[model samples]
Target: MPSANGDSTRNHLAVNPVFTAEPAHIPRNTLPGDGLAPDVAYQVVHDELMLDGNARLNLATFVTTWMEPTAEKLMAECFDKNMIDKDEYPRTATLEHRCTRMLGDLWHAPPADDVTGCSTTGSSEACMLAGLALKRRWQHARRAAGLPADRPNLVMGINVQVCWEKFANYFDVEPRLVPMQGERFHLDAEQAAAHCDENTIGVVAVLGSTFDGSYEPVADICAALDRLEAERGWNVPVHVDGASGAMVAPFCDPGLVWDFRLPRVASINTSGHKYGLVYPGVGWVVWRDAAALPEDLVFRVNYLGGDMPTFALNFSRPGAQVVAQYYTFLRLGFEGFRRVQQTCRDVATSLAERIGELGPFRLLTKGDELPVFVFALRDDVTGYSVFDVSAHLRESGWLVPAYTFPAHRTDLAVLRVVVRNGMTHDLADLFLDDLRLAVERLSRQAKPLRGAESASFAHGASAHHA
Candidate 1:
């Protein structure tokens, strides 16, 4: 047996094993035969994480990067709790229900004693649930009408988040994605109604488009749908993919009629971790009423499982985000959320204005709607593309993204910036300074780098899908 002193020395984690002449190098592909000391293992992982970008300076993502210290503490405390274990943690479940009902009220669901909604891992999962519901409801209607539902299709803009595509592929529903027209980066009322028929299950309206952070005309889309139903007898519902704007418009643009006020809107989804002012990996979905979600109907896919049950974002996701969302609701109330979101809007618009004034770029959106904006290089400036500017900004610890428009507008490429809660006025000024210097340096460069290093970062709505 080894001596007691030897065992003690081996167990001591305070010792810096890396400082020794021969450093330890273990393959991470397989489980190690030996165990490491707790503190030593922690130090190794912590050091590796130093390579991550500063979240506050990250302009590419829409997820929340800053939270109150108290919120952080609460999230840390509940990290061990699983959302699926509702029976074991009754209080957490109750809080989740309360948050759901609160969102229902905020979205202006029809006044009722019982509201139907749920918390999700994020908007992706919530969107899946809502899409499933739409499909099932359409199936029921087709079956009742003595018609075949074999060719079920969903109408939506091509700019929708990737999750919708995944949902359609998985559920075997045909996706009727409306393509973008010239100068029309997103879907419009005419395009949405034109794609509908008897087989159309629902139409998706994006409250905020990630391409330009502009709101689609929800009321106009609804009116078109109403006319279609009156003319063709096809009563199609609308699903609002408000992953970012559902939390925004009710507070910032209360006059905007995009939510439940439009009876055609059957469901809506939002990321609580995005504009809702919480951390990542949390989202909310609310139905207009109990009839909107066909929860009682059995949906079975035998290859996966004989009798598969459906769920929202709460299956096995981190429960702490839900707790953190509850804390935000209680701590901020309605007015507090408005102030924080408004501040973000102010920063976004101010920064966009300053960037437009730089003379080398053209303004696409003012950030007045979603606290996000996109700008393209002026046609006369040919020395550098938006990709070069994006790559150069990455050097200064900023992460503005540059990408080309989809479909009909692929010829246009632009750089985008998202002004979140922590990006204050001072930081905006610093960003403006860096942008000016970048333009000047790249303007004088010999030739275009062809956006050499821009591929490393994610592109378009999928990056900010939250």
Candidate 2:
């Protein structure tokens, strides 16, 4: 009924409506009757995220916060692909296998050709897989020796991440956590050896501890286990939780003997998303040899149109992170990784030195081994605690976490900072400036800073479980 021009006008009117002065607010708990425009929907969600702490200023998390544009493109391209479907995405599977082999070689696996490993959703899943293998291997050995495998246990420091506890609870293994004492923040060889028996599945040695970022003595633990084997006939293997240090120690400190070079370390798990310089949701676990991971734990499935050997806790996950990991490996190589890690270490060391000079703070760990450090307020400093400083630092959008030490050391509350790849020296300087200001403000306060008591209590509770 309309002319050509009128029809064109009508089509334009339908396609592009005038902006509404009062846009409908999005429902918080229910769906809307109509969908919003793409840009409006994006704006609404984006605006909400502005309340979050900037990832760049968050020194609390060990996760990687930045990546190359090319890696981002690669990740975006493969987000829809499922990592478990090997037949559909053969290249991704090949990349995953290559990454495993590379990590195995990096860890100095004895039989390079026979090395076995896999990609996990994250370090937690990787840890779970590693724990399962140890449990299964222990059970098989017990059955072979005509012994009971009912009372399996895992030995680790109280400083271990919560994932270890989850692994123990979810898989029916008793956690024999070694209590932390004064000046001894991690599991020692003597402590590890004393906790082992025939029922012990394995000892978990953290290369980079989550509590204070110190590398536990991996070699010493292994030697103690060796001695235990000779004296009591109980051979306990070791699994290194190298979440932050696996990619670090190899690149920064090449001479470290914490990996496959050690006879007792049967397996290791590292976060690809952490020091490996990839985004979140990628982890790697590698065994010293194929025999280290029991065959019963691996299940052969033909569901995705071909036979695939799946050993991960997660059935389907985004293959994008694995691709990003491979991209990083190719892009960085050994020298590039070393340079980045060394830079971070330098920054951490410099910060630690400066913080120690502040008079009111004492250095716990000086970022000597890993690119992370912890500091606590000097006991003489009254009124303001480390928690007050942590709270005040948030005013400048910095997220520095303050928490107490585990078990016997609950009284030792401290602040921790993780210097990751993107943390430039300039940003470090800014953080130091802000930290000094925060300390000065807290020092001048008449009474204990607000929330100081609650923060102390909360950290004490957390450390009780640590």
Candidate 3:
């Protein structure tokens, strides 16, 4: 029977005969008088989900689309546990603790028991926490010296994720976003320094920029901040939003001096679900040391039995993702992780190279940095826009995104592809064939056929969640 929710796959035969009196139409906006049988309810939701695009073929997102069967099983087992209830689920909490320790070491923070970190819902929450830490630390220093901490500001590239914008808005901090100028797509040493003032709380340097998947110059930005302190006595800390790069750079680009190896970096964050090779909704943030994060922000609760010190924006989230992260860490040690990331980087660079050879495309980034790349149509070959190709690819179940650049480069429109863990050489080869065909077919059009769907494409703060 068809339902008001528009689910036509509802089998009238209920899992239990007693529940056969299930209503003809499933109530969507209103609470149901009686629930449907388990099988019937499951079928109704499952069938509708089939309309979604193939996850394995989704090139628009940096999130992981696949994991091993064993990891999946482990996640299923831990779904019942609450991450916030540290006392009840001691082992789960321990795993979370261990992951932070590992990340601190990975980022090369000084060996100290007080270096604090926590897992959040994802990188967005992690960023917010890091921002709060930066703001609080700055406030404390100013107050101690009897200077008014009223006008706090944060500096970052225009390409930073939306979470940072939210932090500025919600917390009443002024955002000094360095705009993208001609030939400069992200925050550079000179631009970053120029944006800072005595009121600046901290500077954010993205380890992996969502706009083009290139790393902003964290080292240069830090050095620039150091110069600001020495020259003007304005000491500003740096926070690396390594949501994608934190996991990739360590294993792939071993010598990158973007982490705690730089003295001015106070904090760093990463999405465990992205390049960390786990499923969705797990993130980590590590402070250089306990001093970087103000003490008053942490809360200790004994209501759940043992007194636990916690710092997170979320409460009572499923512990499955954290458990999965621990399993991944144990399963793939240093060398194992190195191989997986290295393979992904190789696949991305190879795909980007072949994509550039497909006639009309010009590469903005080559995927060597973050296993991601952006490309745009050449000026001479202008029959259709990149959005036209994005819409075309969606018809074939691929979700490659197309959006224009921000600020000064708003004139430039392009398509971006994120090559994640499961993207194999075979899939890349298949995508190239599809892209070749798409380009050849679109060349026949006399003018642009930009669809209304193209209006939805946006980059930076508006579309950072993707």
Q: In candidate 3, what are the lDDT values of residues 412-448, reduced to their tens digit? A: 8889999888899999998988888888889999988
Candidate 2 lDDT (Cα, 0 to 1)? 0.87
In model 1, how large is the Cα lDDT of residue 438?
90
Q: Enumerate residue pairs that collide in model 2.
A: none
lDDT by residue for model 2 over 289-365, one digit each (tens)?
A: 87998888889977457666779788888999999999999999999999999999999999999999988999999
lDDT of each: 0.85, 0.87, 0.88
Report the C-alpha lDDT of model 1 over 1-466, residue by residue, as the tens digit.
3355432223322335664332255444456467766666677668767878888999988899999999999999999998766666668877998998999999999998877788888888889889988999999999999999999999988788888888898899998878778778788999999999999999999988877888888999999999999999999999999999998899999999999999999999999989988998899889999899996643333322233233553457668999999999999999998998899999999999999999999998999999999999988888888889988898999988888776667778888898888999999999999999999889897767876245455543443231
- By TM-score, highest first, what's the ranking? 3, 2, 1
Please identify which of the two predictions, 2 or 3, would achieve the higher TM-score against the true structure: 3
lDDT measured at residue 203 in model 3 versus the true structure, 0 to 100: 94
Q: Best TM-score goes to which candidate? A: 3
CA lDDT for candidate 3: 0.88
What is the lDDT for 360 in model 3?
97
- Show the lowest summed lDDT stretch of 10 residues, model 2: 7-16
Q: Residue pairs in steric clash, candidate 3?
A: none
